[model samples]
Target: MYLVGKFEHSVNAVQLSALLDITYKTAWRMLNKIRSVLSMESQQIWGEYIEVKHEIFNQQALLSDDRLQKERSVAIIKSVKRDENNCSSSFFAFQLLSRRKQAREVLEHSEQAEILIRLNLGGHSSVDMNPRFQQFQKRNTAGDLVNSGKRTCHPLSVIASNAFSWMKDKFHGIGDKYAQQYMDEYCLRLNASTGAITCAFEHTASLSLQMKH
Candidate 1:
């Protein structure tokens, strides 16, 4: 609770152990179990106009050759009704994909038209631009739609940048296996918006209660 909610940060086993006056193994087990409850598994997300972005990060390991590179994709979905009111409420989904095939499969599963993709100027776009996906009509000009004299508004890109910055500032760096858990935590924060710290505490406590029963 203190490490995750109070500090709004992530700590490795050793750091957690020292902070909590517990053994390293005990801290590791505790953190992993808590992360399990926060996992966003099998959730379905849909949107009329969606923004998708991908970023790759490198994590360090003990051995010189043990470093690994991982890619994460973020999709921000805007609801049609909110767009009409000029107040867009964004819903997001995230996946940790290491291969192009995995990335393609996830995008196919979402399957929304009027999609705005944000990529580095020369970066590889793993999204398949199939005619079928493009055929679906746009309900609102929401994501990435720039108005006259306004700079392009890529909401997902902003979200991704902030998310990555938060992770780095709080946790330093995360492992590939636990990457999704951190992403899920941030998504929960985004959804809650206000009173996010309280929301995180409530969520973890609720899941803990369920496990005991």
Candidate 2:
């Protein structure tokens, strides 16, 4: 049932329940389990000319007293590699800040450096030498990354915007608690054409076998 339609169109609990002829609770649990497996499978270490940017979901709520609980700050990292013909292909990863963490603090220069170190643990050159990293560092402030005056509609921005729209349209806007899981689902779906579904199934089977032992 999960593999039913185009991979881009996610199967929500309501749709899954109707398709599988099961109770909503059961369908929700099953979908969550699948999303959990996908999240685990998608935890990849990115390298080679990585580009990092911040995207905020629910921007209108950023100034609210309970903004920390309502606003979601995500770091979108794109890793690009060039082929023999100088053609480039990109892979993406998304990381969300903890509910209590603010974007400005967590997406700052130091934090971005930490993320780069983690992604390039294979001991690539100093991140400072990376032009993409330099571009990120040149930003006046982390806050500007999230609340920039000019909203250029770049590819990464379009992906982030689509993610927000997907969540709002499919699930009627997810809460902070399970937002990351939904983000994982979206990432997996985005990469589905690149054999991500096979990887997710393999991870799911491995997890099931481990549980049996």
Candidate 3:
């Protein structure tokens, strides 16, 4: 009952521990296991139109009195509409010491054009393609495709926005290291809504990741 309830909502380890009347360590372990499954399930989802966007969060170190003196900021990458119908989304969080290179690095590596080309070649129609994405689809030049993902990537889907809001409310603040895990959990929930929740559970169970007691 606890696991199922937790799956339905976003609750951090501390809150989950208090809710279940269990030790914090045990709660953390259980949440980690579940998050692992969610991450695995997200990896299995493939799509053509992936919108990569970044969200900025304030670092804990900058919360104190020294807030004005070059406050540190962290950015996380989130991808939405992995499939043609915009049914799935995925998120990734990366740590950066320098903010100057964050946007450039994301654009250089995400390969939005490559994903679109491969999917279009594979015969999947893009669902919510931006104008730039359409241009990439029509053109074959490497220069046109490269560095275009940054501009073509749209904002988050409605479901993704809701999930992020839910996570933010539940956790108060998210850390850089575990942002991916939390994002995966939200993705699983969003994906499960397309069909039956049982199927999502079954899919996670099929993965060979060993779980603890």
lDDT of each: 0.50, 0.60, 0.46
| Selected candidate, larger TM-score, 1 vs 2 | 2
Q: Cα deviation in Å at residue 92, candidate 3? A: 12
What is the alpha-carbon lDDT of model 1 when measured against the actual structure? 0.50
- TM-scores, each model vs. reference: 0.55, 0.69, 0.51
Number of the candidate with higher lDDT, 1 or 3: 1
Per-residue lDDT, model 1, residue 180, is 71
Per residue, candidate 1 scores C-alpha lDDT tens digits across 23-122 of 9999989887777776532222333443344433342234232233234333433222144556645455454544544332345433323233221212
Cα RMSD of all models vs. native, in order, equals: 9.6, 6.4, 9.5
Q: What's the CA RMSD of model 1 in angstroms?
A: 9.6
Model 1: CA > 4 A from native: 10-14, 40-93, 101-153, 195-198, 211-213
Sorted by TM-score (best first), the order is 2, 1, 3
Clashing pairs in 1: none
Best by TM-score: 2
Best by the lDDT measure: 2
